[model samples]
Target chain A: MKLLQLAVAVLLVAVLGGSPLSAGARTWQIDPAHTNFYFTVDHIYSKVRGHFNTYSGAINFDPQRLGESSFSFKIATDSIDTNLAKRDKHLQSADFFDAGSFPEMTFASTKVVDAGQGRYDVHGTFTVKGVAYDLVLPLTFAGVKEHPAMKGKEVAGFNGTLVLDRLAYKIGDGKLYKLGVVGKDVEVLVTIEALADK
Target chain B: MKRTLLQIFFLGIGALVVAGGCALPFLYPTQTLWYKTGWEKAVLQTGHLFGVFAFLALVLQLLFGSRGALLERAFGVSLVMRLHRANGQILPLLVLCHMALVLLPEGLANLPLGLTFWPEMVGGAALLAIVVQVVAAQVRQRFSLDYRRWRSGHRWLGYTVLLLAAVHVLFVADSFASGLPRLALLLLVGMMALRLVYRMVSSRR
Candidate 1:
């Protein structure tokens, strides 16, 4: 009877301890003021650079419990700015992102693999224009420090680059892309700074 | 010898116009997409060149028909009339080529329509006006149309074509959308308008 009770106790402790809620994962809110999501693509012989003006995300991170760490982000598609209003309108039109139908793009991490040091390989599903694609983002955690202005609050920084296939996402007219009106691969550079929830 | 020198000078001006129009696309190229293949680049460039040529040809048609003192003295009234007729025939062909080449890479299925493509629609209107002007002129004698009435209609249609063409060129492409190219186009159109106005006022007098 005692042996059975001891087994039950051990199982309960193991189950509770392994739960993500109890894994010491810290929830961090993305700081829109400091975060940047810039993208670059080849436009003929030149490179066109643009960025999303509105995006928000959260990071659930615990260095000790890497398996429980995850990241999620949502970006407003209409907030894309390429410094040219005409191009931006085209990007938001049916020929491109179709922002009227798909107003937001989202990303959710499925797995996170530590690569030693401050680097991590985050495998996630990125949904754009109503299509989801598996993507792996190699990110560097730039350590954490107390907010200089906001005393007692902690801030963490992360940055990574992601290459997206525009055709796969149906972001633009395939025929135009084939004729080289726009590039196939779009490189996205992400820089995120988050404040740990109190 | 003086007449020959004047002819050479006019020919040099025509060459400069053609060269300048062709060079605008390259010099003020919009950083949109680097064409993937040589064939596409050539086709697209040729399409733009044709558009420029068509506009210039329309302007030349006006110049030939103007019966200006310099043109009358250099080429005689009969020769100027022949040049005007020949340019009218070629103008429609150049416009046709421009439409075909520009639409080739973009595909006919993706041809932009409605108010959103206002500049392209203006170009279409200009093309329609050119065709009507040319066809009417061709059939004028067969239809027993009075020369005075036909000439008045032709002059008005010419003005309309020039207005539409100027608007299309200014708004249709990125090259002439702004900067020095836009300023130059405005200056050329301004000169053409002044000449037309002068002709109208002088004829009335």
Candidate 2:
């Protein structure tokens, strides 16, 4: 009787660990209208700030089941906007993102670590210009509540920042970076507002 | 004394124009933001400054070439012609420096090209025009070129360079993309066009 009970318990644990939904994590789709993805980089004497205008993601999250939570995003590389059309074109050219050959940059979480007090460190693989690099984005849960405008809907917000080396991803000409025409470190600011799927 | 005063007044106006043109790039909002290291910033700004000075020199070359009655009276014809020759000789050197400095930061590999870089290509054409005009002027006697033909070609080529440089400046960067800088550039270029037209008509008459 003891052996049978132990086997049943082990099977139950494996099933719950393998399936995210069974573990109580809910699926949430990113609300594009309410989310923002911004980035900044040094350009000669002033910083250039820009954002990706088109992106979509899904989040499987549960405060009680942190281990089962995950996040995945797909951003259209050609949607980069820097206010200056010439610069934007340059960035999208072979010199930078090479958005022509690589139309999308993606991130999928491998792990998420809770740091207490509504903070989390998300480790993921970030791909840009067909180059992939491991990245850790530090995020803060900004709380969840009923949607103000949408009836019978819940919205959750997550904000995070990640510093990436442009050279690692080969985002720009390495020679330019060495000459300090553009700095290597790029700061990406992410604010995601997601809606729970019923 | 009257001639001296007029000379001084015109000289003052010339100095003011150069100063104002040089200041326009720095007045750009992006100028104040810290995006690059001190040395890189210095190199980039110096490159822009060189381009600005070159443009001013080109404009002044036109003014001196005009040999207008007012300029001749304010400064003798000999002095004006001498200034014109000296300015022309230095123009090529200024342009080379501007090109080198601007390319240093981004490197030669990233030298802008293609249809997307039309403004920069226009600037490149202007540089080529300068080279052609200078070389032709220097070799005219060797080639036994006709004086009238050479002068006419030189005049039209100078006008072309002026127009090309103006378009490059107006569209090349965000600094002059809008607002005060755009207005100032249009006014300056328009004034030059008017002056050139007036000179052409007056000469024909």
Query: How badly does each model clash, as a count of residue pairs?
Result: 2, 3
Error of 1 at B62 (Å): 0.6
Q: For candidate 1, lDDT tens digit of each residue in B1-205?
A: 8778777878898899889987877787643324324665677777888988898899899889777887777778999999999999999999999999876655454455667668889999999999999999989968888999999899889989999999988877878887888898888889889998898799899
Deviation (Å) of A115 in candidate 2: 21
lDDT of 2 by residue, A134-185 (tens): 8887889998899888888899999998788888788865766777678889
lDDT of each: 0.83, 0.82
| Candidate 2 ranges beyond 4 A from true positions | A1-85, A88-198, B29-34
- Fraction of true interface contacts that also occur in model 1: 0.00
**Worst ten in a row by lDDT for model 1 chain A:** A85-94
Cα error, candidate 2, residue B115 (Å): 1.1
Docking class of 1: incorrect
Which residue pairs collide in model 2, if any?
A: A44-B36, A45-B35, A46-B35
Model 1: clashing residue pairs? A44-B33, A44-B34
